[model samples]
Target: MTTSWWTFGLQTVNFLILVWLLSHFFWRPVAAVIERRRQMARDLLDQAQADRDAAAQALEEARRRSAGFEEEREKILAEAWREASEARSAALVQAEAEIATLREQSRTAIAQEEEEAARVWTARAGELALTVAARLAARLDGAAVTETFLRWLTDKIAALPADVRSTLGAAGEVEIVSAAPLEPGLQRRVGAEIGAALGASLSFSYRIEPDLIAGLELRTPHLSVRNSWRADLTQILAEINHDERI
Candidate 1:
């Protein structure tokens, strides 16, 4: 193999020149493009992160507003319920008062009606008793009733005090009234018996009064005595009616 030192030198020089040209031209432009692409990607990533933070803040604000609105609604509903309850209680109280008033009025009216009824019944009973007594008295025998009253009168005069009897004895005259005319024999007997009982001579005069309803009456100027069915019945009816009222 023959040695070629010059050709080897020339090949080495050409390789060195090619390497410097590629480093100055192709390598520098490619490095610059790659650096520009990397810078753009970093800017996009930072912008995306900022947008995400803004969206998160907005969502939080909306949630807080919604919570506040819910609280306000609940407060309003509670106030409305309280007002309704108070109104219902007031209405109930008013209704109860009205009912009590009505009951009192009814009781008063009933009491008044009962009192009126009792009064009417009492009056009717008095009238009926008076009617019955008048009918019974109408059927009595006038002469017999008069005789009985005369006997009673004689006994009453006999039982008088000594002073009263003496005063009667001193009177000028006595009067006897009857429902019917008495027989002359009966009149003489009555005058004689009464004068004997009083131990004094007395003058007597008899008068007839048909309204006496079967009874007798004795009278002097200072004193009078009546024993008649009509008078007795009137007093009895008055006493009965007074008791009923009580």
Candidate 2:
């Protein structure tokens, strides 16, 4: 078919108009919408990345803060424990100091009491010595004082001291014991009794007091009894004188 020139021209014009219409109206608006959507997606992705970074930073900061809090709590607990221990130690020291003070006070009191007692005892002893010396001066001297006093002393000693008189018998024996002219039986009797009482054996001496008018005299360290006629006669004469006076 032979195409007409005018139809071809019209068809070309229509094709051109369609392309222009698509480019200007449909393609331009569609491309603009697609670009806008792409931009929005990119911005959302950037925001998500920023949020993730912020979360990671916050988490690290929270962990550091938690660790610092734990360390502080432990330090506080340790300080409290140390303070309690110091308080206990101070209390114990005070208690020991009080005990030491009490002990010293008690020791001082006891020492003072003992010293005072010793002083009192010393004064009493001095007074007793003076009294004993005065009595001794009266009885232990003077002449015939020896012979006559010895005679009197011997008889009185046979009766024992007033303190021990009750233990002695009414018929106490008298022996004039002698190492010389000494009889064995005399030694045995005197030694046994005196040994039992005093836990020691007795000693003897020989004596012939030419002054003794008759019977012998018995003697021990602390005792001497005169069993003599002279002693008896003197006593009898005194008794007769007493009867005459009555």
Candidate 3:
């Protein structure tokens, strides 16, 4: 309150010096430290940003890889399903083909068996019929029957192959009925009868039978005929059957 002007000026100058010294020494260093700290903090923030960006990028890559794997899995599954379906179809087709082949084979085999059986039956029936006819014919006998039978038998025998006809035994030798002898009439001229019937040289043998109801049965290698009552009845019945057929 009692200060001079010079004292006031001096005090102002001193205050200015103090402010300058404080700024140069203590405050300036502190500001620099603060600025340095702020720069370091900024650098740390940049590094953290970069790390976060890298992490995000890695996550994206991992997502992409997962997507690729998933796509592959889906593709593989689809392919597998397709293959399985194809395989199933192929198996079904194969099975059907095999079944068809087997069925055809079975049909063929059955047809073959049937044909063979028919052939065997036909052969057996033919043989049995011939044998039965031979046995039946042996019992027949008669003069008129013998003449008719000789005519028919001669014609049939002439139709046979020469080799078979040549082997024929004498007509009289073949016994129709064992109990009776060959008729003396046929026995006397058997050679001439055979020669006339065969149109060639001939031989003969004698046989007799009574079972034919009075008739004669003649047989050659290639021909047989019963000239007897039994044959007469059979012929009549056959004629009746033929009339019925007509």
Q: Which candidate model has the greater TM-score, 1 or 3?
A: 3
**Candidate 2 per-residue lDDT over residues 44-111, each given as its tens digit:** 88888888889989989999999999999999999989998898899889888888988888888887
Per-model lDDT: 0.77, 0.56, 0.66
Each candidate's TM vs. the true structure? Answer: 0.44, 0.36, 0.45
Models ranked on TM-score: 3, 1, 2
- Give the runs in model 3 whose Cα sits over 4 Å from its true position: 1-55, 127-150, 157-191, 201-246
Preferred candidate (TM-score higher): 2 or 3:
3
Top-lDDT structure, candidate number = 1
By summed lDDT, which 10 consecutive residues of candidate 3 come out lowest? 170-179
Q: Indicate the TM-score of model 3.
A: 0.45
